[model samples]
Target: MSNQEKFVVSRIIPAPSHIECVSGGMFKLADGCPITVISPLAEAELSATLHDTCNVYWKATPSFSFQAGGEGIAADGYRLRVTAEHCEITASGLSGIRNAFKTMRQLAESERGVLKSTCWLLPPVAVEDEPALAFRGIHLCWFPETPTWEIEKNIRLAAYYKFNYAVIESWGMIRLESHPEYCWDEFAVDKKEVSRLVKLAASLGLTLIPQLNLFGHATSSRCGSGKQMLLDRHPEYASLFEPDGWTWCIANPCARQYLTELVTELHDLFDKPPFFHIGCDEAYNAGSCSLCRENYPAKLKAHLMYFYSLFAKRGARVMMWHDMLLNRDDPRWEGYTAYGHSSRGLDELYKELPKDIIICDWQYGYPEKDGKEPDWRTSHFFKQTGFDVLVCPWLERRGIKSLGCLAKQEKLFGILETTWHWYRGSFRKETLFVIASNAAWHPDWTPESNVVYREYLNRHLREMDQDMKSKKYIQFGSVQYQINPAPYQD
Candidate 1:
């Protein structure tokens, strides 16, 4: 056989056109690395998986060579060898890429090609595939009200895509204020809900970071509950600021005490190691409080420093949102979780924060915008700052073409895809998982490019059925909403 021609299955089976379109087939390399092979057979399996998984449109065609590592293989349980050379992985169809991904998991971490319930694969596949940033995480819908099994399902899905971090926001388990089951006390019967997920994430090598809205966001606070409503009654507790006819008073002593207690209470809820996300965003209405206004900048700094110190004392690190600096008035303020925002907002804060703080730059690009969508400038800036960075993409956003295959090949630090309960029907977990596995090997890929995606699909189908060819036109739609209030709705 030629150097390029290692092996090919002689017996081929036929699959549906759609199946042949999205996937080709996967190959177990000599080094045990899973490589994608494009052909008719692979596509059949891909269509089968997608038909069994989601309602999305996909098209795959063409034969392409994509692999993610040096030639690797395993002879038995006792003998394993992988070359130190960089790995190369390629696939045409989206499904083809996904099957290859599963194969990788089986090769890298699993024995007997069987994966435990909660399992995934990280890096070191290729020497050059190092993340540009250290900290990467999902920022929304982290705290879901769904059954524990579903939440755990989502967790595994996230890990399978090779994402290492996720934010458990305050939306799940506890209903927001005034919605319905609003318990006046900060009690939690579902506190144990996170136990299984926490253990599962740990086992999968993913971090589950807890996030709670600390000052502001009284949407959960009511008129009767004195603590939940903040110190609006005291007026002394609000922040001091005037932006477009509004001033938030952060000087209020009552507010400080309230936040302190809230943080302490949340800390006790988790059974795992203590890393917390203190949401300090949208404090525009703060600082105007009596005591906060007196020392404004100094006090704001003090407040953040004090809180961070508290968490540090407990052997935990605190992450705060970096939006407050956009005020233009609070230029001196620098403490936050990470410099996170869309690609458009990155350059504005590049020079402001400490180098130690990481940045999470996000973008949800589609075919209309170009398949290889992402703000490359942000990546360059993050590299320049010597700070860590991660990419957060909205895979299911409306009006955006889903380019699962293309995104996986990008040079990004890590991929963070979201699944909000409110927008649950957007994309299937299957689609997200396939794309995420693509990201694990290639972080800086652009979705607008179809060359790689098409190749991946072809390979996947070829593996499942040999008597299939390129096909097109699989349609799926996703609906997304802006958080802004509508004129006709509440």
Candidate 2:
């Protein structure tokens, strides 16, 4: 065995200095501190080894050293060597350590490595890094009853790709009746489990943002005997109903109280950041209720003002969808807080909301945009708008390929990829949720570039042939094109 092979390598370390008898080196572990030391070459190889874990590590040779950093194939470990002046972690070295480092810097400014095993080298001095956008992130897991492997995988890839924020839309965490764990009509949320998910996301250098629905899409509230359904109890607060059976409501005292309680609980759960997305879109029947019809404009204005006061008191920056205020013909979307669309209302929305409030324009999978189309058409317009925008996409097969192409575009702020199990089935089937997630994180990463993601998905499908499948599977017998829209979707 070589001299470098004699010692049991607990983990790689950065370059070390030997003044007296004691040697100082860096190692891999969470928190702050070093524990052991291996060979000088082992320290250099730490960046290469970092691929096996999501945590950060330090690399050290003799003359040069660097924190394991970079993204894409380059960051995976094309070049890893330690030096006196710099710890070189190349683009192709150690599973994109460059990308990882850039992402880490966005989440937390820390000098510490994974563990305190030994004195480790710092990242290479010559390395250069930057993000594709400002709002890169992964969709927070909504179904608490379901396994979080998909979302966990999402954070892992988000870190790999360089996304900085994570937005969660969990029904289970909100103590709602629709969640599977409800017992005897009681509502509850698993706070510890939710915390575990948040910590994991944070460790990956992804900011955690909770998404709370304030209006419309309250199916969760109607689950238990329709008792908690604001629409059922306070019919006056319910949104208008369309002839086509679409339901809507307003911010009456009853609805406001319910929403307040929910927001307060959520605030207690996640107290890190002051920014919250008060979902107020998709109000199908905003003018149907008698009260809403009598005072439509006033109610709308008061709704926003009321929440602005409450959210401001909590020290939170606010974000919301601009759909309710968008005037298709008019240039203005009407003054509103942060607004979002399905990659459709960029031009008008940017003109309406405060510049500081972010815009989340989603494009699920629509690859092309002709004239007057909602998705691609709108995205083309947003390219020229001076506001920050986030592109949201889905995790299905079609969504994966389409979004990979979108992520390659440089003008957009960042992508918000989602692993949705809504309107169809459980999310357990999308086994490669993490792979698609990389599209948002890595500008260079594409659906075609994700061999790991493809292989995992193939395994989950049991290697079927041309037909839909032997039995029922994710891809089915054949492949079909999925649609992409706006900067938001499941």
Candidate 3:
């Protein structure tokens, strides 16, 4: 094959920032050949990942070398060079080295099918890569119906794509030891499972941030589902939430104490991450209770500040949704999803909120005018108000790209791609994950064809299955079943 063809064969997702062909023939890896890693950083995880993904063993001697530092290498950046007989990786830290090996794993797997005499042929190439946004993250929701294996798969895939953080929101899926009624009986995940997942994510260089719906989503269930996870089991606890169970009755001191305990337990279960997500979205009934209505926004502001102090005491900053901070009737946010109502004084909370709390502004649609890029006014508003902002996008490709581009251009904190309920189905193979990853890694990435991206995704999943030693069909595929069961007749 021509040199350009060989280079194209080694392409990987979230494509590296810089890559070029090198003067060398194809690098060959025989079936029994042992790869070697030379580096100051810990090599166990890197070695294991390479073996799992590329089916190559590692030795102590030669072939692969990792240099400690390199010019222009960022904390999470790496430079990789692959020649006919050897590979060299240069990075500044463990994260950079991990990222470099991740890239190399993909490159080797890309040419796994081009084997001759049981030897894989990889193209000679050089790559210098780093994420465009510092905080490349994905927000995953674990529901009662979601399987533990599925959650594990999502976490592994996010790390595989080089996402640095994963915000895990459990919708009544975590079995809180202190408050057993908070989760469903049969589906609740125990502490052991939670710890396993957390350690798995950490081992893969991915941070798992814990999330609890402190204000809204008090039922721990979607509003439309007509289910209240806690109240449905313990009717006596109804007084802690709004009459409809849509939001916590923050005015109640007992309710505050309950939430505090829950937060403390869940936070500790997650190993007390650097950031805690206090879901403060869709609280349409936030101050509807008589006691809460007495002072309205003052009480609301105090409620938020209470948790801010709670988490701060634990050495963690808070993250909350931005819907309630922006006025819904404002002309500037006419087409956006702003839930703040001026009549209730919720529209001005932004002015009083602490600057350290990261505002997660979720814009799920293409809000830009025709032929123009999105202005991301909401994110800019938060930043202008002196608060760090994380632009959140869900499922929409245009919105993901637009918000990601805005985050990069404005130098905002980063992008958090939310995959609510969609992560459980065929959407796993959809372009959303790849697109979001690429958007966070390289905002200016050229969109690849869906077919081509799908191939990359499939190969990644296959490699993951191999690493996991999965035996069942449900372990790795677009869908768990070939056909959908008839409604109520499984």
Name the top lDDT candidate. Answer: 3
Candidate 1, residue 317: Cα displacement in angstroms equals: 3.0
Candidates in descending TM-score order: 3, 2, 1
Tell me how candidate 3 scores on lDDT: 0.80
Q: Is candidate 1 or candidate 2 better by TM-score?
A: 2
| Stretches of model 1 off by over 4 angstroms after superposition | 1-136, 140-147, 172-189, 215-250, 264-274, 327-355, 361-387, 395-423, 426-437, 444-490
- Name the weakest run of 10 consecutive residues (lDDT summed) in model 1: 9-18
lDDT tens digits, residue span 29-86, model 1: 2233332343323545554543322111122221333333322221100111123322
* Ten residues in sequence with the least summed lDDT for candidate 3: 56-65
Write the candidate numbers in order of decreasing lDDT.
3, 2, 1
Estimate the Cα RMSD of every predicted model relative to the unseen true structure: 13.9, 13.0, 3.1
Q: lDDT for each of the candidates? A: 0.40, 0.44, 0.80
Model 1 accuracy (lDDT, Cα): 0.40
Ranking 2 against 3 by lDDT, winner? 3
lDDT of 3 by residue, 375-435 (tens): 8888888899999999999888888887888899899999999988776544554555788
